[model samples]
Target: MISAYACGPGDEPEAAAGWAFALAASTFCDVVVVTRRRFEGAISSALAARPELAQSLRVIYLDRHPALVALKRGQAGIYWYYVLWQRSLRRLVSRLHEQLPFDVVHHVTFANDWLPCGLVGATSAPLVWGPVGGASASPVRLARWLGVRGSITELVREAITRPLRRLWGDRAAREASVVVAQNHDVARRFAPVTAHAVVEANASILSDDLAAGAASSAAPNLVGPRRAVFVGRLISWKGARIAIAAMADLQDWTFDIYGEGYDRGYLERQVRRLGITDRVRFRGHRPRTEVLAALAEADALVFPSMHDQAGWVAAEASALGCPVVCLPFGGPPVLADVNAHVVSLERDLPAALARTVAALPRGRGERSHRWDAGRLPRFLEQTYDRACATSAVAEERPGRRRVPRPARAQRR
Candidate 1:
């Protein structure tokens, strides 16, 4: 497993996904995980807590070049460092493969499809890329809702990343044995590249947590107006402002905004401008445990994010049996429970949100759905088995192009 940005105890989505996937993979097979040096302490501590699991896992930490390390000060620097890291990883994996000659090489982190997976071409082992994404762009029609600066930033980002997307698509199609897209939009992007792709929600929630959340939902405790909570970074794309805008007409309901980002000041000002500061609370950033606790108490998870590949909170909210109100588009629809509300963005968002909020049940109810963490390991194992089988057939066929396997059937 090559996961450059894998986290150990970190709360970042990428880190959590990497850590959970790596741990899960270790349970099924002897796994070699390559990650950055920064997570060494956390990884060591976590492994120490599970000595039996550690016996089957080998972790290798790779440090970036000093020049690249200094580049962490800016976004460009971080990207450049990632590019350098990929180059370094190719060399590292080539050497590792010579010794171990592993069955598969899975690229797990920096899940964006725009970034090329270095280990794919470096090793003959069947390569699995993703649950990868980054194809979704903020809807141009919703530009005004994002404000002037936010709109420009989104546009600029699209322009700069266009070339990278092309390169990534071409590389993934030619080299990746399996491409796991996080949502339909991303799957469409890779359609031109290769048919060997599948849509799987990347977020992984523990079965125990889901059980606890489900149990919590059966009991109701409410005294005041129903509360709607918004989790995720406070960015225009995350639709925090949209939630605030929606709150203007929802005078009977209180809203809480968690997580912090560059959009904090703008969102704060919008709250003041709307004169609903008293009804809304900016709780800032909180630990994952605390965030889950907050979701348990809330009546609904108001996730208005426009382009999220898969918001983990939506799954968490569903597991807790908390109602979720999200945009009909993107990854949220896939993760949200069947009973959760999905407001259409074709008309006025605030009006749609208002209607959705008004229609939501005032009291807590059992979650109709919950994420099954057990499925992750099974699904990944199935994917690995498929990749290996396909790779063997390709080798036997020599020059013939292998037929793309049916994706949905493999999931079962």
Candidate 2:
């Protein structure tokens, strides 16, 4: 059984990752997916289209209070609501387990590590507690770019998480059979607490025609103005400013912003203030098809997000054979792989990214990104096997003591 509170119609990170894992696991065995009632329409629509999946997949939807649901619509206290919903799942999980014991209990969505996850404690079934993150944070020096409000927010979050990790993070990790961290920093944060932390990206190649795009855009000749795009919610921490700041120096490139948020004003101001008004275009949110097409044709994706747990855009861009210029921090470094030029935060970040963006076309031919079509299934298969094996060993040991798996954490 998997707890996927965010599973729904779109390819948002949590929803996509949760649905992807459930689909991948169904290829191996029957999958019991526990999600919110709100997604029933979309999920049912999808299953109706794929009859074969309906046979092996069982979905149980939990209803949330209307007040909480309404609050979530405006993006207020949603994670708090998620935590309450998760905490309430113990009874449901226990009842389900009593009727038919599950082989594994996986936590898929609300991937942040700081939150309380009741599913982890609800069953003795071997646990898979990620691919989760939230430990990654922006460097104080570089985060000054976020302005005073952003700076204080990060400072407060770091302060709060430190104690919270000690209080609960350690226990959660220690109990998890396999802690799948979304990034290396998150993995390292959980390492001392759990012996089974592994770094794996939560975002996979989810689009239908992405493989075709990946094959065709493997290498390209760049002869005209370079096109670099950023596709994400324009929030303060997303660091659209970093990309906008870099654009001033990148005369050969034209950056098209594909999403909008409150930060749109700040970012647009920066574009004008930089006097590169002609070079930058705030082409607000477009359809997914258009975004994918933009990625397929773009020279590079300049995504300089500060602490993104999993960058869906970076992974999609990379799979489309578009070079990614991202910071060495967060999920982009893991997902982009050889298809990217990771810009470090040490020197002038915008300048570093500018140089990387300028040189990306030449850099692509020097490296190869072997797109693994089977990466998701293969990962899910191994994770479940390892979870079962580890749980079996724990049951055999005195006091049901957890035993760490022999597999060392993957570095790449």
Candidate 3:
């Protein structure tokens, strides 16, 4: 059984994660997924093409109070809605399990480390929580300069999450047979509460044609780095401004930015102020294919995200054999593990980016893929086996979930 509060549409991060995780789990076992009712159409359409998954994968969409829907606009009360939904899910799953008799229960989405999981006492079956995140934070040095809007948003978010971390932190981790953290930071946060914490990225589809446009275009400029690309929302923490700042130093190089957001105006202004208007172009929200193609053709993917739990663009950039220049912190450092340059956060952000490009390794072989289909299934098998084994141990122990801490390297 999979509890993915957000599922389908294949767009929102949580929904994408839920859909990917549930799909992967279904490959190993029959999956009964519980998700929000709004996603029914997208999920149904996705399942339609894959008739094989029709029988093995069943989705249950649960709707929330009509008032909650109103509050969810602009994420005003989305947290409130999710909290109430999770509380209600406990009851739904308890009744569902009496009829279905699930062997293992998994809570797969809304990948926030602090968000409470409802599956804690819903069933006796082994529980798999997370591959979740939300522990990452924007660099204090960079965040302060993002003007009033960005600064306040980060401040307000941190303010809210700090206390909730102490409150819901234990409940989300302790009861699980396995707590699959999306990154090292998330794993560390749960370590104090549960011995089952392990670092594993949320599974994503590995395209069969990863080699389709894997070839890197030759650097056209003789003077400096030729070209760079960035794909993702143009939010303050996403570091699009930093990427644009870097373009100032790469005089001959061109930087193309995809995607639009509240920060687009700010980023564009920074570009003009940097006096790199000719080189830095904002291509606001392009198709994924166009973005991927641009990635293939670019010299580097400068994704300097401040606090990404699972930098999916970094993974995609790496898959296309593009060099990734990202921060030493957060999910980008892990996902952009090869053909990549990790630069430290400094006041002179542009210089760091320039130095990274100069230091980039070229003519590299195929990089490691964390989400390869063959690899993820094998990993899941081990995780399930481990969860069941530990669950058996917990059953014998009763009233306590204890196991030796995983070795340091394994912890990551």
Winner by TM-score between candidate 3 and candidate 2: 2
- Across residues 305-399, which tens digit of lDDT does each residue of candidate 1 receive? 88888888888888777788898667887787664688877668888887898788777756644456566777888888888877777767867
Model 1 C-alpha lDDT versus the unseen true structure: 0.78
Candidate 2 lDDT over residue span 21-96, tens digit each? 8887787777788888878888999898898997778999985678767777544477678777887776799798
Local accuracy of candidate 3 as per-residue lDDT tens digits, 12-65: 656876787777777777789999888998998988888888767899878777
RMSD of each: 4.2, 4.7, 5.1
**Candidates ranked by TM-score, best first?**
1, 2, 3
Return whichever of 1 and 3 wins on lDDT. Answer: 1
Runs in model 2 deviating more than 4 A are 71-73, 207-221, 362-373, 399-412
Worst 10 residues of 2 by lDDT: 403-412
